[model samples]
Target: MKNPETFPHPIGLMLFNRFEYSQQVLMSLSAQTLPVDQSKLYISIDGYSGSKAELQGKPDSTHAIEELARATFPNATIRRAEKNIGIAEVYFALEVSMLESHPDANWIGFFEEDYVPSPDYLEITSQLASAAQPIDDIAVVAATGETLDPDNRDVQGIFPIGHLWAYLVRVAHVRERRDDLEVFRQQMSGRPYWDRDKIALALVMASRGVFPIGVANDYQRLSLMFRFNRIGVTTGLSYGEYIGVEGEHMTEKSFARFKFSAPTTVPFDIATVDFSASISTLRDQYRADFAKSLAEQYVIPKIRAFTAQKSFKSLPRRRRVASLLGQAFRALF
Candidate 1:
């Protein structure tokens, strides 16, 4: 039995450029079955500029968001960034700032702009976290009901990184790890590891025996399809696959784009969709056909003749000489 007052978990929602979608995200938050008093939701508007052009461009979007929060949810705080900060910086800054500001908060959930939760999203997640086993590691139950491939049996309780939009962390765990984040910051700096921070962090935590607890039952209401381009991630809404009576037609709506994961409307045809066997058979058939096509298109005699020619060998030497000459010319100049 957890004390609601002492174990309160505040939720933090990150917003980058998309303003319209924030409204939906808030609406979903307002609908959460969990006690809203213990739950303090913060909406941080990253890259906020107060100039007339900036304000004018975002008038309707900003007004609607502010009004909704003020009229209905006054406890939800909104932080506007004076200058644009990239996602990496914004995430780190918010994590540190919020944890420091709300030291008494028991848990904190981090969400992206597009994640829309079911009504029980918060309550069920809270219960799962409360009942989760293996206390040593950070706990995150998957909120996105839809996974990459339903038939893809190779799945784990811990999901892929981009799906980290709806994750909850025990506040103390986050505070304890706050000092250690610089290690990740340095590891991510000056490299291509910018986008996979969540994955990287999860992997790091798991390496230290921080395992995630999975809850399959609560995620029944989630979508079966993924949206990709919506959040610039290769998974989720970007998949473009649809199900249901109006599944195909629903693709045209912009709001649908906000939901990166939606359940399949039509029941999966399991008879024709033996994904495991289909993948193996397709691989073997494609390899055989590809080998035959290659043999027909590329005769060994022609390949030998082409390889024997000195053109390929000369290319590297030519490049080296050009590089050296360019250096010499620069030196002389």
Candidate 2:
């Protein structure tokens, strides 16, 4: 068994033009009870390609991110991109590089700029990773999951999709499949879909039958169902809150609907977590939530918005008459 007192895995923090959000995550990291070696922290700052005139008036967060990492984590390794390679490429390059550089490292935890982790986040993640390292089937230990009830925190399970916001990755598993990941990354890059990159990672893992274990709420489970036919596993308690609602990709309203609060306290004993019951409960909750969302967001909305222009009262008499006739014929069916 590995030493429980020391956490030897490296952590990679991905950053872009979001200083405030990045700083918030850093602050939360500083509050972790687990002792992390500053030298093990790797920060990658992505570059911007816009013209000088375009950037002159805009606020750039990359510079601020470098400064913050240097000042706060003096011995940390910081890599600043010379060009804007996009987030997908950055993640691929960093993960590959880390695995290659540190062959003995068992796992690596990834943190995006906006994810604010709880005080015990590191401790919990290390413990979970330690437990998962021996399990050949478990590919990840995600910090977040789909929780059915917000008030209840005693849930755990395996889930299909993995959240990149905050999670401990099994380096050995990914390293062994580096070629596959590279091909997947190449295929997913430059896609029009906002989450294509994220989905690609999940797809690769799913193909290998290596599911992720973590905490997820009902909403997250439904989101995963749209991509994968199955929901992996989840726990009732959340380790941290996603505070980057106002970030580049998310709208304020959408963030408000999905943002979840972290649990007051998390169970530190990883072995005590019941995988069988958590998986069953998560699947059941997902089915119910998926049905509710389909009805409210799709079925009901489509039904209510099916009327012709005549329903607006501003249509010409002739058009209104035709619309009414069409509506009547449809109703008769």
Candidate 3:
């Protein structure tokens, strides 16, 4: 039998928290020149905690969201969670729900509350997903906010740079791996680490050799990695040992309190940037400074001593070998 025609609106965006950021994403989607009716919008709100006076009718979050629906896009379906699930759980739950709801959809697009899709975001996604027939192990196609070198841009199609804040993923590829996500969550449960759930998903997808599509100059999405590092490691643990008992040490100087701005801006054109393509020069400067401090104060001296000790290296290498193997398997299929 011949394959079914892919829908132009194969993309479904998952939105949660960040009311202000969500509003920006919604407005950007609304502003797209393509037919909005072709695509579907799903918003998953965890809970609203802000000035009660700011809300209309002083109602709860669901009610406030309902009011938002009436005032804004009433047609957009809004899903509300009763309790507060962390970012990772919320994203996973909503993604599973999206796949269940749209079983026939070729691709489900992921967008954080903070992302503002460019004019051709959906158009380009649909076009690429449709044009790339005989989809093999491919799972994701995304906007790499980091501009590729002029040489590599056209090579092997475009490679997704980084920052998975916004991307389109194959539905079947995701649904088939839903069970594994719970396993991943369980593995990472007690570790108390947090970051973009999509990054975890990307790692899992890439493990299976599923390539993330990168369309040059399509859109820009900000990376929220540093915020997660601060919250997870800096405040959570004072001095901890990672990678089993014989692994690296986490010390006081390894972490520090840092302040970040909400609703940070991302530049459209990045003519000048380090290889990392950091949007803000100041942000890059601060991160570089922090890295230097960490190496000097906490990591370098200790790591040097640890490596120099011959007895430490002679300790059981079996566990380390097994652990490295497991990580490699998890990251590469």
Candidate closest to the true structure, highest lDDT: 2
lDDT of 2 by residue, 240-333 (tens): 7777776445678987776565554645567776544455555565556545544554445444455433454787778767866665445322
C-alpha-based local distance difference test score of model 3:
0.43
Better of 1 and 3 by lDDT: 1
Q: Residue-wise lDDT of candidate 3 within 1-333, one digit each (tens)?
A: 312332354344544433455566667666654545532666666554332222333434445554554356667666666644444555676676666777777777766555566655555455545543343333455443322222222222233233344566666655565554555455444322222244554455345433232111111111122222110001010110111111012223442221111221332221321222322433444345434533454455555565567765675888546644554444333
Model 1 Cα shift for residue 112 (angstroms)? 2.0
- Which candidate model has the greater TM-score, 1 or 3? 3
Q: Provide the global lDDT of candidate 1 against the true structure.
A: 0.45
Candidate 1's residue-wise lDDT over 1-333, tens digit each?
323432246677776545556666666666655555523666676654532324446443444455655555676677766654445555677676667778776667777656666555566456535543234232343345433232221222222222344666556555554443554455455532223355555455335433222111111101111110011011122111222112112234653554434532332121332223333443343334333433433344354554466764456877756754554444322
The Cα local distance difference test for each model comes to: 0.45, 0.59, 0.43
Q: Which 10 successive residues of model 2 have the least lDDT summed? A: 212-221
